[model samples]
Target: MRYVDFTSEELWKQFLPGDHLALDTIVKRHYNLLYQYGCKFTRDAALVKDCIQDLFLYLWHRRNTINETASVEHYLMKALRRRLARALSKSGSMEGIGFLEFKDVAASPDEQLIQQEQKAALADKIKKCILQLSRRQQEIIYLRFYLNASAADIADIMQLNRQSVYNLLNDALNKLRQHTGAYFKPAMALSIILLLVLSQL
Candidate 1:
Protein backbone atom coordinates (compact mmCIF):
# COMPACT_ATOMS: atom_id res chain seq x y z
CA MET A 1 0.00 0.00 0.00
CA ARG A 2 1.23 3.52 -0.78
CA TYR A 3 1.16 5.13 2.64
CA VAL A 4 2.73 8.32 1.33
CA ASP A 5 -0.63 9.61 0.20
CA PHE A 6 -2.33 8.88 3.49
CA THR A 7 -2.98 11.40 6.19
CA SER A 8 -1.81 10.62 9.73
CA GLU A 9 -5.38 9.86 10.73
CA GLU A 10 -5.68 7.40 7.88
CA LEU A 11 -2.41 5.69 8.78
CA TRP A 12 -3.54 5.60 12.38
CA LYS A 13 -6.74 3.84 11.38
CA GLN A 14 -4.71 1.24 9.57
CA PHE A 15 -2.37 0.84 12.52
CA LEU A 16 -5.32 0.31 14.81
CA PRO A 17 -6.25 -2.63 12.68
CA GLY A 18 -2.77 -4.19 13.12
CA ASP A 19 -1.25 -3.02 9.88
CA HIS A 20 2.50 -3.00 10.37
CA LEU A 21 3.19 -1.01 7.22
CA ALA A 22 0.88 1.71 8.43
CA LEU A 23 2.69 1.83 11.77
CA ASP A 24 6.04 2.02 9.99
CA THR A 25 4.80 4.81 7.78
CA ILE A 26 3.56 6.76 10.76
CA VAL A 27 6.97 6.44 12.39
CA LYS A 28 8.75 7.65 9.27
CA ARG A 29 6.44 10.63 8.89
CA HIS A 30 6.82 11.88 12.44
CA TYR A 31 10.23 10.75 13.72
CA ASN A 32 12.33 13.72 12.64
CA LEU A 33 9.81 16.28 13.88
CA LEU A 34 9.42 14.42 17.16
CA TYR A 35 13.18 14.19 17.55
CA GLN A 36 13.64 17.92 17.05
CA TYR A 37 10.88 18.82 19.51
CA GLY A 38 12.16 16.26 21.99
CA CYS A 39 15.66 17.75 21.91
CA LYS A 40 14.34 21.09 23.09
CA PHE A 41 13.30 19.43 26.36
CA THR A 42 16.68 17.82 27.03
CA ARG A 43 20.14 17.65 25.47
CA ASP A 44 20.20 13.83 25.53
CA ALA A 45 19.57 12.57 22.01
CA ALA A 46 19.68 8.96 23.14
CA LEU A 47 17.06 9.58 25.78
CA VAL A 48 14.83 11.38 23.29
CA LYS A 49 15.15 8.48 20.84
CA ASP A 50 14.40 6.03 23.59
CA CYS A 51 11.32 7.94 24.65
CA ILE A 52 10.02 8.03 21.07
CA GLN A 53 10.65 4.33 20.71
CA ASP A 54 8.90 3.64 23.96
CA LEU A 55 5.97 5.85 22.95
CA PHE A 56 5.47 3.90 19.73
CA LEU A 57 5.87 0.61 21.52
CA TYR A 58 3.29 1.69 24.05
CA LEU A 59 0.92 2.64 21.23
CA TRP A 60 1.41 -0.70 19.50
CA HIS A 61 0.79 -2.63 22.67
CA ARG A 62 -2.39 -0.73 23.44
CA ARG A 63 -3.63 -0.07 19.92
CA ASN A 64 -6.97 -1.61 20.56
CA THR A 65 -7.61 0.69 23.50
CA ILE A 66 -6.39 3.90 22.01
CA ASN A 67 -9.05 6.19 20.68
CA GLU A 68 -8.90 8.33 17.56
CA THR A 69 -7.44 11.80 18.05
CA ALA A 70 -7.90 14.98 16.04
CA SER A 71 -4.18 15.32 15.47
CA VAL A 72 -1.77 12.41 15.38
CA GLU A 73 1.12 14.85 15.66
CA HIS A 74 -0.22 16.52 18.76
CA TYR A 75 -1.11 13.18 20.33
CA LEU A 76 2.36 11.80 19.78
CA MET A 77 3.94 15.06 20.93
CA LYS A 78 1.91 15.13 24.10
CA ALA A 79 2.80 11.52 24.82
CA LEU A 80 6.48 12.14 24.11
CA ARG A 81 6.43 15.22 26.30
CA ARG A 82 5.07 13.19 29.21
CA ARG A 83 7.60 10.42 28.70
CA LEU A 84 10.49 12.91 28.57
CA ALA A 85 9.21 14.57 31.71
CA ARG A 86 9.22 11.28 33.58
CA ALA A 87 12.67 10.34 32.29
CA LEU A 88 14.13 13.75 33.11
CA SER A 89 12.63 13.72 36.56
CA LYS A 90 14.10 10.30 37.23
CA SER A 91 17.57 11.45 36.15
CA GLY A 92 17.34 14.81 37.98
CA SER A 93 17.93 16.74 34.77
CA MET A 94 16.52 20.18 34.13
CA GLU A 95 13.32 19.66 32.10
CA GLY A 96 13.83 22.51 29.63
CA ILE A 97 16.89 22.90 27.43
CA GLY A 98 17.14 25.35 24.52
CA PHE A 99 19.02 23.44 21.84
CA LEU A 100 18.86 24.95 18.36
CA GLU A 101 20.80 23.99 15.23
CA PHE A 102 21.31 26.75 12.65
CA LYS A 103 22.78 26.96 9.16
CA ASP A 104 25.02 29.81 7.94
CA VAL A 105 23.63 31.65 4.94
CA ALA A 106 26.55 33.94 4.09
CA ALA A 107 28.20 34.12 0.65
CA SER A 108 31.91 34.46 1.46
CA PRO A 109 34.06 32.61 4.01
CA ASP A 110 34.68 35.77 6.03
CA GLU A 111 31.04 36.76 5.76
CA GLN A 112 29.97 33.28 6.77
CA LEU A 113 32.14 33.50 9.87
CA ILE A 114 30.68 36.87 10.77
CA GLN A 115 27.09 35.67 10.20
CA GLN A 116 27.74 32.52 12.21
CA GLU A 117 28.99 34.58 15.15
CA GLN A 118 26.02 36.92 14.94
CA LYS A 119 23.51 34.08 14.67
CA ALA A 120 25.16 32.28 17.57
CA ALA A 121 24.94 35.38 19.72
CA LEU A 122 21.28 35.82 18.87
CA ALA A 123 20.54 32.14 19.54
CA ASP A 124 22.21 32.45 22.95
CA LYS A 125 20.11 35.45 23.81
CA ILE A 126 16.92 33.71 22.68
CA LYS A 127 17.82 30.65 24.70
CA LYS A 128 18.32 32.70 27.81
CA CYS A 129 15.04 34.53 27.25
CA ILE A 130 13.15 31.25 26.70
CA LEU A 131 14.67 29.72 29.82
CA GLN A 132 13.48 32.64 31.89
CA LEU A 133 9.84 31.96 31.02
CA SER A 134 7.73 29.88 33.35
CA ARG A 135 7.55 26.28 32.19
CA ARG A 136 3.94 26.61 31.03
CA GLN A 137 4.71 29.86 29.29
CA GLN A 138 7.73 28.38 27.53
CA GLU A 139 5.66 25.43 26.34
CA ILE A 140 2.90 27.73 25.08
CA ILE A 141 5.46 29.65 23.00
CA TYR A 142 6.98 26.44 21.69
CA LEU A 143 3.72 24.84 20.61
CA ARG A 144 2.31 28.03 19.16
CA PHE A 145 5.35 29.15 17.19
CA TYR A 146 7.82 26.30 16.83
CA LEU A 147 5.20 23.64 16.22
CA ASN A 148 2.82 26.00 14.43
CA ALA A 149 0.00 24.58 16.47
CA SER A 150 -3.37 26.26 16.67
CA ALA A 151 -4.89 27.25 19.98
CA ALA A 152 -7.29 24.30 19.79
CA ASP A 153 -4.45 21.88 19.17
CA ILE A 154 -2.42 23.36 22.01
CA ALA A 155 -5.42 23.15 24.31
CA ASP A 156 -5.81 19.48 23.42
CA ILE A 157 -2.14 18.73 23.96
CA MET A 158 -1.74 20.71 27.15
CA GLN A 159 -5.14 19.69 28.55
CA LEU A 160 -6.15 23.31 28.94
CA ASN A 161 -9.16 25.26 27.79
CA ARG A 162 -8.92 27.02 24.42
CA GLN A 163 -9.26 30.41 26.08
CA SER A 164 -6.55 29.47 28.55
CA VAL A 165 -4.22 28.60 25.69
CA TYR A 166 -4.90 31.97 24.09
CA ASN A 167 -4.31 33.81 27.35
CA LEU A 168 -1.12 31.90 28.08
CA LEU A 169 0.16 32.54 24.56
CA ASN A 170 -0.51 36.25 24.91
CA ASP A 171 1.13 36.40 28.32
CA ALA A 172 4.11 34.36 27.14
CA LEU A 173 4.71 36.63 24.14
CA ASN A 174 4.54 39.68 26.37
CA LYS A 175 7.09 38.20 28.75
CA LEU A 176 9.33 37.23 25.84
CA ARG A 177 9.22 40.75 24.47
CA GLN A 178 10.18 42.08 27.87
CA HIS A 179 13.05 39.62 28.16
CA THR A 180 14.28 40.27 24.63
CA GLY A 181 13.66 44.02 24.47
CA ALA A 182 17.10 44.72 23.11
CA TYR A 183 16.78 42.31 20.18
CA PHE A 184 13.12 42.99 19.43
CA LYS A 185 12.08 45.81 17.15
CA PRO A 186 9.18 47.98 18.28
CA ALA A 187 7.00 46.74 15.43
CA MET A 188 7.92 43.05 15.58
CA ALA A 189 7.65 40.39 18.22
CA LEU A 190 11.04 38.69 18.43
CA SER A 191 9.59 35.49 19.93
CA ILE A 192 7.53 34.70 16.85
CA ILE A 193 10.29 35.48 14.36
CA LEU A 194 13.04 33.75 16.32
CA LEU A 195 10.96 30.68 17.08
CA LEU A 196 9.98 30.42 13.40
CA VAL A 197 13.67 30.53 12.47
CA LEU A 198 14.53 27.85 14.99
CA SER A 199 11.62 25.71 13.81
CA GLN A 200 12.99 25.76 10.28
CA LEU A 201 16.38 24.69 11.61
Candidate 2:
Protein backbone atom coordinates (compact mmCIF):
# COMPACT_ATOMS: atom_id res chain seq x y z
CA MET A 1 0.00 0.00 0.00
CA ARG A 2 1.31 3.42 -1.00
CA TYR A 3 0.19 5.22 2.12
CA VAL A 4 1.84 8.43 0.89
CA ASP A 5 -0.47 8.41 -2.10
CA PHE A 6 -3.60 8.06 0.00
CA THR A 7 -6.02 10.84 0.80
CA SER A 8 -6.53 11.82 4.42
CA GLU A 9 -9.78 9.91 4.55
CA GLU A 10 -8.22 6.83 3.04
CA LEU A 11 -5.34 6.92 5.48
CA TRP A 12 -7.88 7.34 8.22
CA LYS A 13 -9.72 4.21 7.13
CA GLN A 14 -6.57 2.14 7.13
CA PHE A 15 -5.55 3.64 10.45
CA LEU A 16 -8.84 2.50 11.92
CA PRO A 17 -7.86 -1.04 11.17
CA GLY A 18 -4.67 -0.62 13.27
CA ASP A 19 -2.31 0.03 10.38
CA HIS A 20 0.68 1.78 11.91
CA LEU A 21 2.20 2.77 8.59
CA ALA A 22 -0.98 4.54 7.58
CA LEU A 23 -1.13 6.28 10.94
CA ASP A 24 2.48 7.36 10.74
CA THR A 25 2.07 8.68 7.21
CA ILE A 26 -0.91 10.76 8.24
CA VAL A 27 1.01 12.33 11.13
CA LYS A 28 4.10 13.08 9.06
CA ARG A 29 2.06 14.86 6.42
CA HIS A 30 0.27 17.13 8.88
CA TYR A 31 2.78 17.74 11.68
CA ASN A 32 4.06 21.10 10.49
CA LEU A 33 0.67 22.75 10.42
CA LEU A 34 -0.14 21.21 13.81
CA TYR A 35 3.16 22.28 15.37
CA GLN A 36 2.88 25.84 14.14
CA TYR A 37 -0.62 26.05 15.54
CA GLY A 38 0.50 24.42 18.76
CA CYS A 39 3.15 27.12 19.11
CA LYS A 40 0.49 29.78 18.92
CA PHE A 41 -1.48 28.74 22.01
CA THR A 42 0.92 28.52 24.90
CA ARG A 43 4.18 29.92 26.23
CA ASP A 44 5.59 26.46 26.85
CA ALA A 45 6.93 24.70 23.79
CA ALA A 46 7.05 21.56 25.93
CA LEU A 47 3.37 21.79 26.67
CA VAL A 48 2.50 22.25 23.02
CA LYS A 49 4.78 19.42 22.06
CA ASP A 50 3.27 17.16 24.65
CA CYS A 51 -0.22 18.02 23.53
CA ILE A 52 0.48 17.17 19.91
CA GLN A 53 2.27 13.99 20.88
CA ASP A 54 -0.52 12.94 23.18
CA LEU A 55 -3.19 13.78 20.64
CA PHE A 56 -1.66 11.57 17.96
CA LEU A 57 -1.21 8.83 20.50
CA TYR A 58 -4.86 9.04 21.39
CA LEU A 59 -5.74 8.93 17.70
CA TRP A 60 -3.80 5.71 17.30
CA HIS A 61 -5.23 4.20 20.44
CA ARG A 62 -8.80 5.12 19.56
CA ARG A 63 -8.89 5.28 15.80
CA ASN A 64 -12.17 3.45 15.64
CA THR A 65 -14.05 6.48 16.96
CA ILE A 66 -12.46 8.91 14.54
CA ASN A 67 -14.92 10.84 12.47
CA GLU A 68 -14.99 9.71 8.84
CA THR A 69 -15.68 13.17 7.43
CA ALA A 70 -12.85 14.92 9.27
CA SER A 71 -9.70 15.45 7.27
CA VAL A 72 -6.38 14.77 8.99
CA GLU A 73 -5.85 18.46 9.65
CA HIS A 74 -9.32 18.89 11.10
CA TYR A 75 -8.91 16.12 13.62
CA LEU A 76 -5.53 17.40 14.70
CA MET A 77 -6.69 21.00 14.92
CA LYS A 78 -9.82 20.10 16.85
CA ALA A 79 -7.86 18.09 19.39
CA LEU A 80 -5.19 20.77 19.65
CA ARG A 81 -7.78 23.48 20.08
CA ARG A 82 -9.33 21.57 22.94
CA ARG A 83 -5.93 21.11 24.49
CA LEU A 84 -5.20 24.84 24.16
CA ALA A 85 -8.50 25.75 25.72
CA ARG A 86 -7.62 23.58 28.65
CA ALA A 87 -4.16 25.14 28.85
CA LEU A 88 -5.51 28.68 28.68
CA SER A 89 -8.11 28.00 31.31
CA LYS A 90 -5.38 26.75 33.60
CA SER A 91 -2.81 29.50 32.90
CA GLY A 92 -5.41 32.28 32.95
CA SER A 93 -4.10 34.05 29.82
CA MET A 94 -3.88 33.16 26.15
CA GLU A 95 -0.92 35.19 24.96
CA GLY A 96 1.37 34.38 27.74
CA ILE A 97 3.04 34.36 24.32
CA GLY A 98 6.45 33.78 25.78
CA PHE A 99 7.84 30.80 23.82
CA LEU A 100 9.38 32.72 20.91
CA GLU A 101 9.56 36.21 22.29
CA PHE A 102 9.27 38.57 19.34
CA LYS A 103 11.75 41.05 20.76
CA ASP A 104 13.93 41.49 17.66
CA VAL A 105 12.09 41.90 14.41
CA ALA A 106 15.34 43.10 12.93
CA ALA A 107 16.90 43.22 9.49
CA SER A 108 17.78 39.95 7.81
CA PRO A 109 20.29 38.96 5.08
CA ASP A 110 17.42 38.58 2.64
CA GLU A 111 16.91 41.63 0.41
CA GLN A 112 13.39 42.03 1.68
CA LEU A 113 14.92 42.37 5.13
CA ILE A 114 13.12 45.59 5.87
CA GLN A 115 9.77 44.08 4.94
CA GLN A 116 10.52 41.02 7.02
CA GLU A 117 11.57 43.19 9.96
CA GLN A 118 8.37 45.17 9.84
CA LYS A 119 6.38 41.99 9.58
CA ALA A 120 8.07 40.60 12.65
CA ALA A 121 7.55 43.81 14.56
CA LEU A 122 3.90 43.74 13.63
CA ALA A 123 3.67 40.14 14.78
CA ASP A 124 5.30 41.10 18.07
CA LYS A 125 2.82 43.89 18.63
CA ILE A 126 -0.04 41.60 17.70
CA LYS A 127 1.11 39.04 20.23
CA LYS A 128 0.95 41.63 22.96
CA CYS A 129 -2.47 42.63 21.73
CA ILE A 130 -3.80 39.11 22.12
CA LEU A 131 -3.02 39.23 25.81
CA GLN A 132 -5.34 42.19 26.13
CA LEU A 133 -8.51 40.52 24.93
CA SER A 134 -11.23 39.12 27.21
CA ARG A 135 -11.28 35.36 27.64
CA ARG A 136 -14.36 35.15 25.44
CA GLN A 137 -12.52 36.94 22.65
CA GLN A 138 -9.70 34.46 22.90
CA GLU A 139 -11.99 31.43 22.75
CA ILE A 140 -13.91 32.79 19.79
CA ILE A 141 -10.73 33.36 17.87
CA TYR A 142 -9.66 29.79 18.52
CA LEU A 143 -12.80 28.17 17.15
CA ARG A 144 -13.18 30.47 14.19
CA PHE A 145 -9.73 30.22 12.64
CA TYR A 146 -7.28 27.77 14.23
CA LEU A 147 -10.04 25.23 14.44
CA ASN A 148 -11.24 26.38 10.99
CA ALA A 149 -14.71 26.27 12.39
CA SER A 150 -17.34 27.75 10.16
CA ALA A 151 -19.60 30.31 11.77
CA ALA A 152 -21.98 27.48 12.49
CA ASP A 153 -19.18 25.24 13.75
CA ILE A 154 -17.75 28.03 15.88
CA ALA A 155 -21.17 28.71 17.30
CA ASP A 156 -21.41 25.05 18.17
CA ILE A 157 -17.92 24.77 19.56
CA MET A 158 -18.20 27.88 21.71
CA GLN A 159 -21.85 27.38 22.53
CA LEU A 160 -22.89 30.69 20.99
CA ASN A 161 -25.51 31.53 18.43
CA ARG A 162 -24.25 31.68 14.83
CA GLN A 163 -24.68 35.46 14.70
CA SER A 164 -22.88 35.81 17.99
CA VAL A 165 -19.75 34.10 16.73
CA TYR A 166 -19.79 36.34 13.64
CA ASN A 167 -20.15 39.44 15.78
CA LEU A 168 -17.41 38.35 18.16
CA LEU A 169 -14.96 37.59 15.35
CA ASN A 170 -15.57 41.04 13.83
CA ASP A 171 -15.14 42.66 17.20
CA ALA A 172 -11.89 40.81 17.77
CA LEU A 173 -10.62 42.14 14.43
CA ASN A 174 -11.60 45.67 15.35
CA LYS A 175 -9.74 45.37 18.63
CA LEU A 176 -6.68 43.98 16.83
CA ARG A 177 -6.75 46.87 14.35
CA GLN A 178 -6.36 49.31 17.18
CA HIS A 179 -3.52 47.24 18.60
CA THR A 180 -1.22 46.74 15.55
CA GLY A 181 -1.01 50.54 15.02
CA ALA A 182 -2.14 53.06 12.42
CA TYR A 183 1.04 53.45 10.34
CA PHE A 184 1.38 49.76 9.49
CA LYS A 185 0.49 48.57 5.99
CA PRO A 186 -3.07 47.29 6.22
CA ALA A 187 -2.59 44.03 4.33
CA MET A 188 0.62 42.94 6.02
CA ALA A 189 -0.67 44.25 9.31
CA LEU A 190 -3.81 42.17 9.04
CA SER A 191 -2.05 38.96 8.08
CA ILE A 192 0.19 39.20 11.12
CA ILE A 193 -2.70 40.30 13.28
CA LEU A 194 -4.68 37.22 12.34
CA LEU A 195 -1.63 35.09 13.04
CA LEU A 196 -1.44 36.50 16.54
CA VAL A 197 -5.16 36.04 17.05
CA LEU A 198 -4.93 32.45 15.90
CA SER A 199 -1.88 31.77 18.02
CA GLN A 200 -3.23 33.11 21.26
CA LEU A 201 -6.53 31.38 20.78
Candidate 3:
Protein backbone atom coordinates (compact mmCIF):
# COMPACT_ATOMS: atom_id res chain seq x y z
CA MET A 1 0.00 0.00 0.00
CA ARG A 2 3.07 2.25 -0.28
CA TYR A 3 2.79 3.05 3.42
CA VAL A 4 6.48 3.82 3.42
CA ASP A 5 5.78 7.26 2.00
CA PHE A 6 2.92 8.01 4.35
CA THR A 7 3.25 10.50 7.14
CA SER A 8 2.66 9.23 10.65
CA GLU A 9 -0.67 11.03 10.86
CA GLU A 10 -1.87 9.46 7.63
CA LEU A 11 -0.76 6.03 8.74
CA TRP A 12 -2.51 6.52 12.06
CA LYS A 13 -5.70 7.53 10.36
CA GLN A 14 -5.56 4.51 8.12
CA PHE A 15 -4.96 2.26 11.12
CA LEU A 16 -7.96 3.70 12.92
CA PRO A 17 -10.02 2.44 10.01
CA GLY A 18 -8.68 -1.09 10.49
CA ASP A 19 -6.09 -1.09 7.76
CA HIS A 20 -3.65 -3.85 8.70
CA LEU A 21 -0.93 -2.61 6.41
CA ALA A 22 -1.12 0.83 7.96
CA LEU A 23 -0.81 -0.65 11.40
CA ASP A 24 2.15 -2.73 10.36
CA THR A 25 3.93 0.25 8.88
CA ILE A 26 3.28 2.29 11.98
CA VAL A 27 4.78 -0.41 14.16
CA LYS A 28 7.81 -0.80 11.96
CA ARG A 29 8.42 2.95 11.93
CA HIS A 30 8.21 3.35 15.68
CA TYR A 31 9.33 0.05 17.16
CA ASN A 32 13.00 0.96 17.49
CA LEU A 33 12.22 4.32 19.12
CA LEU A 34 9.88 2.73 21.64
CA TYR A 35 12.45 0.06 22.44
CA GLN A 36 15.18 2.65 23.01
CA TYR A 37 12.90 4.63 25.33
CA GLY A 38 11.92 1.44 27.13
CA CYS A 39 15.62 0.60 27.65
CA LYS A 40 16.08 3.90 29.49
CA PHE A 41 13.80 2.56 32.22
CA THR A 42 14.97 -1.05 32.37
CA ARG A 43 17.89 -3.10 31.14
CA ASP A 44 15.69 -6.17 30.63
CA ALA A 45 15.36 -6.44 26.87
CA ALA A 46 12.86 -9.26 27.06
CA LEU A 47 10.59 -7.35 29.40
CA VAL A 48 10.76 -4.26 27.21
CA LYS A 49 9.96 -6.26 24.08
CA ASP A 50 6.98 -7.88 25.80
CA CYS A 51 5.61 -4.55 26.96
CA ILE A 52 5.95 -3.05 23.46
CA GLN A 53 4.12 -5.96 21.91
CA ASP A 54 1.40 -5.67 24.51
CA LEU A 55 1.10 -1.97 23.78
CA PHE A 56 0.59 -2.61 20.06
CA LEU A 57 -1.93 -5.35 20.70
CA TYR A 58 -3.87 -3.08 23.02
CA LEU A 59 -3.77 -0.27 20.49
CA TRP A 60 -5.01 -2.50 17.69
CA HIS A 61 -7.88 -3.79 19.81
CA ARG A 62 -8.92 -0.30 20.81
CA ARG A 63 -8.10 1.55 17.59
CA ASN A 64 -11.54 2.99 17.20
CA THR A 65 -11.53 4.38 20.72
CA ILE A 66 -8.07 5.87 20.57
CA ASN A 67 -7.82 9.62 20.35
CA GLU A 68 -5.76 11.26 17.62
CA THR A 69 -2.46 12.63 18.82
CA ALA A 70 -0.30 15.30 17.25
CA SER A 71 2.70 13.00 17.46
CA VAL A 72 2.29 9.23 17.22
CA GLU A 73 5.79 8.74 18.63
CA HIS A 74 4.92 10.72 21.74
CA TYR A 75 1.66 8.83 22.25
CA LEU A 76 3.40 5.49 21.84
CA MET A 77 6.18 6.49 24.19
CA LYS A 78 3.72 7.53 26.87
CA ALA A 79 1.74 4.34 26.52
CA LEU A 80 4.89 2.21 26.62
CA ARG A 81 6.09 4.04 29.71
CA ARG A 82 2.81 3.33 31.48
CA ARG A 83 2.83 -0.30 30.44
CA LEU A 84 6.46 -0.80 31.58
CA ALA A 85 5.79 0.95 34.87
CA ARG A 86 2.88 -1.37 35.61
CA ALA A 87 4.89 -4.46 34.71
CA LEU A 88 7.84 -3.35 36.83
CA SER A 89 5.60 -2.48 39.77
CA LYS A 90 3.98 -5.88 39.59
CA SER A 91 7.43 -7.49 39.78
CA GLY A 92 8.51 -5.10 42.58
CA SER A 93 11.44 -3.94 40.47
CA MET A 94 10.43 -0.38 39.75
CA GLU A 95 13.14 1.00 42.00
CA GLY A 96 15.85 -0.74 40.03
CA ILE A 97 14.73 0.56 36.62
CA GLY A 98 15.16 4.33 36.50
CA PHE A 99 18.81 4.80 35.68
CA LEU A 100 19.76 6.19 32.21
CA GLU A 101 23.07 5.06 30.78
CA PHE A 102 24.83 6.90 27.98
CA LYS A 103 26.13 4.95 25.05
CA ASP A 104 29.08 6.05 22.92
CA VAL A 105 27.97 7.99 19.85
CA ALA A 106 28.29 6.21 16.55
CA ALA A 107 30.18 8.05 13.82
CA SER A 108 31.61 7.17 10.46
CA PRO A 109 35.40 6.86 10.34
CA ASP A 110 35.67 10.00 8.18
CA GLU A 111 33.33 11.96 10.44
CA GLN A 112 35.18 10.76 13.53
CA LEU A 113 38.50 11.86 12.08
CA ILE A 114 37.08 15.24 11.15
CA GLN A 115 35.73 15.94 14.62
CA GLN A 116 38.13 17.77 16.92
CA GLU A 117 39.38 15.89 19.97
CA GLN A 118 38.51 18.80 22.26
CA LYS A 119 34.95 18.94 20.95
CA ALA A 120 34.63 15.18 21.33
CA ALA A 121 35.94 15.37 24.84
CA LEU A 122 33.44 18.12 25.71
CA ALA A 123 30.60 16.06 24.27
CA ASP A 124 31.68 13.07 26.28
CA LYS A 125 31.79 15.21 29.40
CA ILE A 126 28.30 16.52 28.60
CA LYS A 127 27.01 12.98 28.30
CA LYS A 128 28.49 12.12 31.68
CA CYS A 129 26.97 15.27 33.15
CA ILE A 130 23.56 14.23 31.88
CA LEU A 131 23.88 10.85 33.60
CA GLN A 132 24.56 12.62 36.89
CA LEU A 133 21.14 14.24 36.84
CA SER A 134 18.18 12.77 38.74
CA ARG A 135 16.11 10.19 36.88
CA ARG A 136 13.32 12.67 36.19
CA GLN A 137 15.82 15.22 34.96
CA GLN A 138 17.44 12.73 32.62
CA GLU A 139 14.06 11.67 31.25
CA ILE A 140 13.07 15.27 30.57
CA ILE A 141 16.36 15.97 28.81
CA TYR A 142 16.02 12.89 26.67
CA LEU A 143 12.47 13.74 25.69
CA ARG A 144 13.03 17.43 25.12
CA PHE A 145 16.35 17.40 23.31
CA TYR A 146 16.91 13.90 22.02
CA LEU A 147 13.38 13.24 20.84
CA ASN A 148 12.79 16.86 19.87
CA ALA A 149 9.44 16.67 21.61
CA SER A 150 7.38 19.74 22.31
CA ALA A 151 6.85 20.83 25.88
CA ALA A 152 3.21 19.77 25.69
CA ASP A 153 4.19 16.37 24.32
CA ILE A 154 6.73 15.96 27.10
CA ALA A 155 4.20 17.02 29.73
CA ASP A 156 1.71 14.49 28.40
CA ILE A 157 4.30 11.72 28.38
CA MET A 158 5.67 12.60 31.81
CA GLN A 159 2.19 13.25 33.25
CA LEU A 160 3.24 16.69 34.36
CA ASN A 161 2.01 20.20 33.67
CA ARG A 162 3.51 22.01 30.68
CA GLN A 163 5.02 24.61 32.97
CA SER A 164 6.52 21.89 35.12
CA VAL A 165 8.12 20.35 32.07
CA TYR A 166 9.62 23.68 31.12
CA ASN A 167 10.87 24.30 34.65
CA LEU A 168 12.35 20.85 34.94
CA LEU A 169 14.14 21.17 31.60
CA ASN A 170 15.52 24.54 32.60
CA ASP A 171 16.72 23.17 35.89
CA ALA A 172 18.30 20.16 34.22
CA LEU A 173 20.15 22.31 31.68
CA ASN A 174 21.33 24.63 34.42
CA LYS A 175 22.69 21.67 36.34
CA LEU A 176 24.44 20.40 33.24
CA ARG A 177 26.14 23.74 32.74
CA GLN A 178 27.18 23.96 36.38
CA HIS A 179 28.43 20.38 36.48
CA THR A 180 30.46 20.81 33.27
CA GLY A 181 31.94 24.10 34.42
CA ALA A 182 30.96 25.73 31.14
CA TYR A 183 29.09 28.95 30.59
CA PHE A 184 25.39 28.66 29.85
CA LYS A 185 25.77 29.35 26.13
CA PRO A 186 28.58 26.86 25.51
CA ALA A 187 27.00 24.26 27.72
CA MET A 188 23.72 24.56 25.89
CA ALA A 189 25.45 24.51 22.50
CA LEU A 190 27.43 21.42 23.39
CA SER A 191 24.39 19.65 24.77
CA ILE A 192 22.34 20.29 21.65
CA ILE A 193 25.16 19.04 19.44
CA LEU A 194 25.80 15.96 21.54
CA LEU A 195 22.12 15.12 21.85
CA LEU A 196 21.66 15.45 18.09
CA VAL A 197 24.57 13.08 17.60
CA LEU A 198 23.12 10.54 20.03
CA SER A 199 19.62 10.80 18.61
CA GLN A 200 20.83 9.78 15.16
CA LEU A 201 21.59 6.36 16.61
The 0-to-1 C-alpha lDDT of every candidate, in the order given, reads 0.74, 0.66, 0.78
Q: Quick one: RMSD of model 1? A: 5.1
2-76: candidate 1 lDDT, tens digit per residue: 899999999999999789889999999999989988876776899999999999999999999998877899999
Candidate 2: tens digits of C-alpha lDDT, residues 18-58: 99998899889888777776665555778788888888898
**Residue lDDT tens for model 3, 1-201:** 688999998899999979988989999999999998899888899999999999999989998899777788888998999899889988997653464555665433334423455555656666677667788877887777778888988899988899998888888777767765642355256455445346545
Q: After superposition, which runs of candidate 2 have C-alpha atoms over 4 Å from their true positions? A: 84-131, 135-161, 178-201
TM-score ranking, best first: 3, 1, 2
Number of the predicted model whose TM-score against the real structure is largest: 3
Clashing pairs in 2: 40-199
TM-score list, all predictions = 0.74, 0.62, 0.85
Worst 10 residues of 2 by lDDT: 98-107
Best by lDDT: 3
